[model samples]
Target: MSQAAADTMDNTHAAEHGGHHGEHHVLPYTVYFAVYGSLLVLTGITVLVSFAGLGKWSIPVAMAVAVVKASLVVGYFMHLKYDDRLNSLILVVTLLFILIFFAMTFSDMRTRGMIDPVEDNMVLRNEQAAEKAAAAEASGESSEKGEEAHHEGAAEH
Candidate 1:
């Protein structure tokens, strides 16, 4: 083949196959509007939840709504839905690690009192005793200096 024909063929191949290599813009105008609308609705729900005074449920509800909104933004606006499989896998793995970390933290919190309840109290008492000792030392040093001053005054008289 001529060099010109080869160049044209290469360009055509790139045009066809390059979609997967970069961010693919797939959704149209109406889809973008819908995504934005859903995001706004989620925001409103979060705000309403904040006002509802459900106590503990408030945080869970707000968090759930926020997660949904984040998923929408990630899958649509950020083009994660059209992203490469490796990128999707990385996101999933990252989320899994975060969940594992949270799970471990909660596990520790749940079992904290079971191991030895005295440890916590001992820590508090030790802190209090250290403070008391420091205060007493300061007061004793001041009183000794005052007495020494009195003795010097008596000697001068």
Candidate 2:
């Protein structure tokens, strides 16, 4: 094989011939620059979104940008795009598991108050009690009546 033709291969077959034995992939400078530029743009987008007051959508938007940035770094810098298919598959599966775990944890956190409002939602319970106390005061009910009710409930416990 010609010298140029021989140098183009990056597989085990080429490694056996002492050709590109150590370097599996060799991308040009332009690819690295493009990846770097994309990462910078995504970072800018993340910052803008934070100040944009997107409210509930900001987290999802930032996560999307972050995922893109991570993909570029993993694919180009880590050379996972040119690596074995099995390696890529393993990475994808691991990420999916992590996503599932975070989703489940968030779901549980959001539902804890519903599962036991009095105990799990102490702040909400306190706010509700304060509102009741205010309403009683506004309706011209004696403060002692409210205190007695509170003490009576505490005594029942």
Candidate 3:
């Protein structure tokens, strides 16, 4: 084998194995600081929003901010931005499945009460109490007396 041919084979082998001798990308200190600053700002926003009395909207808003922060960290700090496209695609697909799972779980939880006989019974009890109050008012009777009589009847059992 010729010396030049051997050298060419070595180069080809190195290239095939993913040449680590190639130039690497290095992020500047400013970039790191910017990402850190952005994360801090998002944390502050999360705290502020918690105190803003958003009620039911707070959890979703905070989760959204957290997702943005996580993306920034993964893309820049974790070097996924400079990584192979396949890895990025895998991450996206994994996130999509996780989101779908959460959606399905939440849907199941939200609909559980609708199918529960205990919940239906509670609703029926509230309606019956309201009707009883209306009937008592029409008969010029106090609800307190009705409640007392009901309690006494219950105590006999």
Candidate 4:
């Protein structure tokens, strides 16, 4: 075939397939630099917060900073911001589910001690001792004498 005919055929094929025609979306260099700088600044903030002794707030603050950094990376670096709205919604829903899973796991872990069986460990033993001491105090008896008697009974056994 002639060169002109081949060019026409290629154009026709390109039009048939989505009309991409060798086109692409190129982001500016400054945008990438900005994202990099923001990530570095957020890393510094995370380190500073760790050393500042924020205690209970440290983890939450660090997580917030991380989420912001991740958003920037996903939006700009991953080009999700310019992508379809459905993709963004999918990302949001996935993140929401991850947050829910983490919350449930942490809740279960933190409450494990509270729901442990009475015969499980030393925690219940200490609680029982405290309760006995309180009962002795309410009955106008000396807790120290009660403890000594309990020890003597244990020794006899």
**Per-residue lDDT tens digits of candidate 4, residues 1-157?**
2553454455445444655435443556766887899999999999988999998998999999999999999977886655555678899999899999999999989867865475566576677888977888899887788889889999999
**Candidate 3: segments with Cα more than 4 A from true spot:** 1-23, 116-157
* lDDT-better candidate, 1 vs 2: 2
lDDT by residue for model 1 over 21-99, one digit each (tens)? 6534445666578789999988998998899899989888889999999999997788666556567889999999999
Q: Candidate 2: minimum summed lDDT over ten consecutive residues — where?
A: 1-10
TM-score of each: 0.59, 0.59, 0.58, 0.57
Summing lDDT over every window of 10 consecutive residues in candidate 4, give the lowest-scoring window.
1-10
The residue-level lDDT of candidate 2 at 92 comes to 90
Q: What is the C-alpha RMSD of each candidate to the true structure, in Å?
A: 16.0, 9.2, 12.6, 11.9
CA lDDT, candidate 2, residue 97: 100
Q: What's the C-alpha lDDT at position 68 in model 1? A: 97
Candidate number with greatest TM-score: 1
TM-score of model 4 (CA atoms): 0.57
Off by over 4 Å in 4: 1-23, 119-157
Q: Once all C-alphas are superposed, what RMSD does model 1 give against the true structure?
A: 16.0
Residue pairs clashing in model 4 are none
Candidate 3 lands at a TM-score of: 0.58
